[model samples]
Target: MKRILSISLLLLFNLGQSRAQSEKKIAFGPYIQQMGTKDAAVCWSTLVGSMTVTDPSGKTDTIREYKQHAIYFQGLKPDTKYSYDVLNDGSNEGKGTLTTFPDKIVPFNFVVIGDTRTRNNVHKKIIEQVTKRDPRFIVNSGDLVSNGWSMKNWESFFEINHDFMKNTPYYPVLGNHEKDSPYYYNFFDLPNNERYYYFTVGDALFIVLDSEGHRTSIPAYTTEGNEDAYWEQSGIEYLKKEKEWLEQVLKLNHQAGFVFIFQHQTLYSVKKSRVEESKKVRAFWGDIFSRYGVQVFLNGHDHHYHHAYDKGVHFITSAGGGAPLYDIDAPQPETVNYKKIEHFINVEVKLDEAVLHVIDIDGNEFDTIKVKRRDVK
Candidate 1:
C-alpha cells in the first residue's frame, strides 16, 4: 500500500507540471484595498477552481471559486503583520508573503505609485522597500505599464507588481494610456462593469474617475467602438452615469473626513497649453467636487509631479514610474490646479486636517500639503 501511494504522488506531480506548461501564464494584480482598522482586501489567480487565506489568528477562510485571476479579501487586522499564501490544490505549498496594514482610523499610512514602466528592476526594488513600511494597501495612480493595449504589456505589469498585490488589495484608476489598451476593463476586477467606481476607507470617500473625458468627447457605452473610439463614447456615458452615482455616494458620506477623486488625466495640463480645451474637465467635474466638498483630485499626466491652487480644486500629479519623463510645457490650462513628478503620494487622514506628502521613487518625501477640512465648510 505504501509503494502504491508513493507512485500516485509522483504521477500527480508530473501531471501538475505538464498542465502548468500548457496553460497560459496567469497574470496577477495592481489594485488592493485597505479600510479602517484591520480590514484588508486581496486578489489572485489560480489554475485550480478556488483558493484560501489563513490569517494571523490561525483562522482559514476559503474565498469563492474564481473564473478569473483576481478578487478582493477584506476583514483583516490593522497595524500588524500577517503571514499568507496562495494555493491551487490541497496542501500543495505555493508562494506566500508576510503582510500587514496600519491600525485603524485615528491615523494611518498608504502609498501611491504611478508610471512604473521602465527599469522594472528599479520598480521592484522600490516595491520591496514599500513592503517594509507595511502599508495597509496600495493605490496605483495610473500608467501601470508602458504600452496600454498589449496583452504582454499588461502581463508584465502584473508580474512586476505581484509582490504587492498577492497580499495587498490594490486600487487602480484608468489612465489615458490605459485606454490605449482593451485588456484593462476585463483584466481588472473593479466594483462595476464600467471603469469609474468608488470605495470607502475609514473616514474618507475615495472616488476614482476618468480624466480623458475631461479632455475629449465621451465614448459611447451601448456599443463598444470596436475601431471607432468606443472608449470615447463609453467614457461620456459612464461619466453621466457616474455623476448620479457620485451624488448618491456623497449624500451618503456627506460628513466624511475627506473626499478624494483619483484619476489618470489631469483636468489641467502641466505645460498649461490648450488651456481652454482642457479646462472643460474641471469646468465639468471640478464643480461637482466643489459642490460635494471633495478634498483633492489625485491625478497623473505630464510625467512629473506638482500641485497648485485652482479655484477650490486641489490638483496632484505623481507620474514618476520611470516611464521616460516628459519635458513639461508650463503655464498649464484655464482650470483650477496642475503639477508633475515621477513620484507618489503618502496620504494621512486626520480629524483636524488631512496631510499629503509628494514622495519620490525611493519613498523619499519631496513636498507636503496640509489642509483643514473645517476651511472647506
Candidate 2:
C-alpha cells in the first residue's frame, strides 16, 4: 500500500512539473515571415515540441518541432488576408493576421528598416510608426540584434516588435552583426534556406544577398567564443556561386519590370568601415546589375542615409533602424543626398514608376525621389 502511494505521489509531482513547463510557453514570435502569394511562413518560439496553426479558411495544421516553430500554410489566395492562431498544448498562445503577396501587378508599398541593434526604445517607436503606415511588407537590411548569436538579444527584438512582426512579413538580409548564427537562420523562414535568395511582390523582384559570406574567418563579435559562433563572409572571395545564381535569377525574372537588390553592406558609403567591401561588390556585381535591368540596390550598414545614381541604377543606404547613428565621413560627389539620422525608406511601386521616400524617426519626410523604369531595349 505504501509503494502504491509513493508511485502516485511521484506521478502527481511529474504532472505538476509538466504543467509548470507548459505555462512558460513562447519566448518570442508567433510572427510572420516569407509571405508568398499561395502561402505564408509563420514562425514562433516555444519548447512545447508541437503546435497548431489555424487559418481563416478553417484549416488547421499541426507543426511538430522543437523551440522554433516554422509552419507554412499553403493554397492561400493571393493578396488575401488570413487571420491565424498559434496554439500550444491545447491553449491559444498567439494570434495575428497577415496578407499574401498580390497576385497581379497592382500598386503596393514596402518599408525598408534595418540596423535595429541594442536600441529598444527607438526600435519600438519605429515599429509603431511603420505599423501605422501599413506597408504590405517590410525589408530589414540586417543587424537585427547587437549580438546575433545570443538568443536573449533576439528575444528583446521580438518583444519590442512582436506587434508588427506578427502581422507583417519581414524579409531580412544578412548583416555583419548577425554573424551567420543558427538562431538567425532558424528564426527566419526565407526562400531557398540559404542566406541569399529572392522573392517577387507584384512586379518587383526583391533579391536579398549576404555580403559577409566571403569572410574566411569569423570576427570576435559574440559573447561566446568565435569557435561556437557562425559568422561568414561570402560576399567577396567566395562569391562566384552567388554571382552565377544572381545572374541566372535576373535573366529569368528581369521581365518582372523592377529589380531591387538588398544586402546588409552597401557597395558605396561615406563611412570608411565599409569602403573596401563596397569596392569589391562594385567591381564584381555592379556591372551585372547594370547589364540586367536592376533598378535599385538597397543596403544598411553605415548607420546613416546616403544615396546616389550611377549608370541608371539607384543606390540607397537606409540603415537607420535604431542603431547608433554615425556621422557622415567625406561625402562623395556622386551622392545624390546624405543624412545623419535614424530613418527608414518607403518604396511605393506603381506600374510605370517607383517612388522612394526617406522618413526620419520624428515622422518627417526628409527626401523623396522617383525612378523611372529602365527601358529593356
Candidate 3:
C-alpha cells in the first residue's frame, strides 16, 4: 500500500509540471511581415524566461524575455487574401489574414501613422481607427515605442497593435528612440537590408530611409567642440551608401506611377526649436526628392501634422500618433498647413492619381491632397 501511494503522488507531480509548461502563453504577435506579391511571413513570440530586479529605492520590477518564431509562405498568388494560423491547435489567437501585393497596377489604399511611442490609450484609439480603414498595408513613420530596449514597452506596443498588425503588413522607419537596438530588427521582418529599404504595391513605390543612422556612443576623451562632428562622421559612410542606393532605386523605378518616401526626422519643420535641424537635413538630401519626382515625403518626430510643399514634393510631418503634441512655433515658408492633433493619413492609390486624406482622431477629414500620377513613358 505504501508503494502504490508513492506512485500516485509522483504521477500527480508530473502532471502538474506538464500543465505548467503547457500554460506558457504567446508573448506577442502572430503578426504579418515582409509581405510581397508572391511571399509573406508570419511571426510570433513566446515567453522564455524572466528576471526580477530591485532598484536602489527598493522598487522591484520583473522583466520578461521572449523568443521569436516565424514561418514564411512562398508561391502565393498576387492580389489574393489568405488565412493563416501560426498555431494549428484550433485557437483564434494565432489566426489572421493577409493580402498579397497586386502583380499589376491596381487600386489600393494604405495608412500611415507616426510617433506611437507613449500614450497607450491614444495609440489604441488611433490603431482602432486605422483598422477600420482596412488599409492594404501600414507604415509607421517611427518612434514606435518610448524605449526600444524595454521589453515592457514593446509588449504594450504589440498588445495595442496586435489585432491590426496580425493582418496588415507593417513597415517601420528607424526613429531616434529606437536607438539602433537589435530588438527593432528582431521584431520586424523587412525587405532589402531592412535599415533603409523600398517596397512596391502595384505601381506605387514606397521608400523608407534611416535618418537616425547607426547609434554610436561618443568616446569619453572626445571634447564637446568635436562632439557634433564625431556623431556625424560616425554614420557618414552608412548614410552615403544609403543615399547612393536611393538614387539608384529612384532612377531604376522612374516609371513608377507614384512615389512616397518616409523617414523619421523631418526635412521641413514648423517648430521653432527644430527648424534649423530640418534645414540641415534638407541640405543633406538636397534635390533628391524633386529630382526623382517623388510625390510625397512623410516623417515623424515632431509630434504634429505639418504639410510643406517644395519643388513639387509634399513634405508631410504626421507624428501625432500618441506622443504629446508640439506647438507650431515657426511655420516655414513652404508650410501649406499645420495642425496640432492626433491623426493618421489614409492614402488611396488610384489609376491616375493618389489622394491623401489627413484624418484627425475624431474621424474628421481636416486636410486633403491629391497628386497626379508621374508621367511614366
lDDT of 3 at 183: 92
lDDT of 3 by residue, 1-377 (tens): 00111000001111122456655345688898999998989888877667999999999999987777888888887887887766665567677888888898989999999999999999999998888889999999999999999989999999999999888999999999888888999999999999999999898999999998874899999999999889988988888889999999999999999999999999999989999888888998999999989999999999999999989999999999999999999998899999999999999999999999999887889999999999988
Tens-digit lDDT track of model 1 for 277-317: 45656666657777777768777655777575665667776
- Which ranges in model 1 have alpha carbons more than 4 Å from their true place? 1-41, 46-67, 70-82, 88-104, 119-122, 180-182, 212-235, 272-277, 332-341, 374-377
The best candidate in terms of TM-score: 3
Evaluated at residue 273, the lDDT of candidate 3 is 92
Residue 25, candidate 3: how far off, in angstroms? Answer: 3.3
> CA shift at 303, candidate 2, in angstroms?
0.6
Mark the 10 consecutive residues where model 3 has the least summed lDDT: 1-10
> What TM value does model 3 have?
0.93
Cα error, residue 186 of model 2, in Å, equals 0.9
Ranking of candidates on TM-score, top first: 3, 2, 1
lDDT, model 3: 0.89
Q: Among all windows of ten consecutive residues in candidate 2, which has the lowest summed lDDT?
A: 4-13
By the lDDT metric, which is better: model 1 or model 3?
Answer: 3
lDDT, candidate 3, at 54: 100
TM-score of each: 0.72, 0.83, 0.93
Query: What TM-score quantifies how close candidate 2 is to the native fold?
Result: 0.83
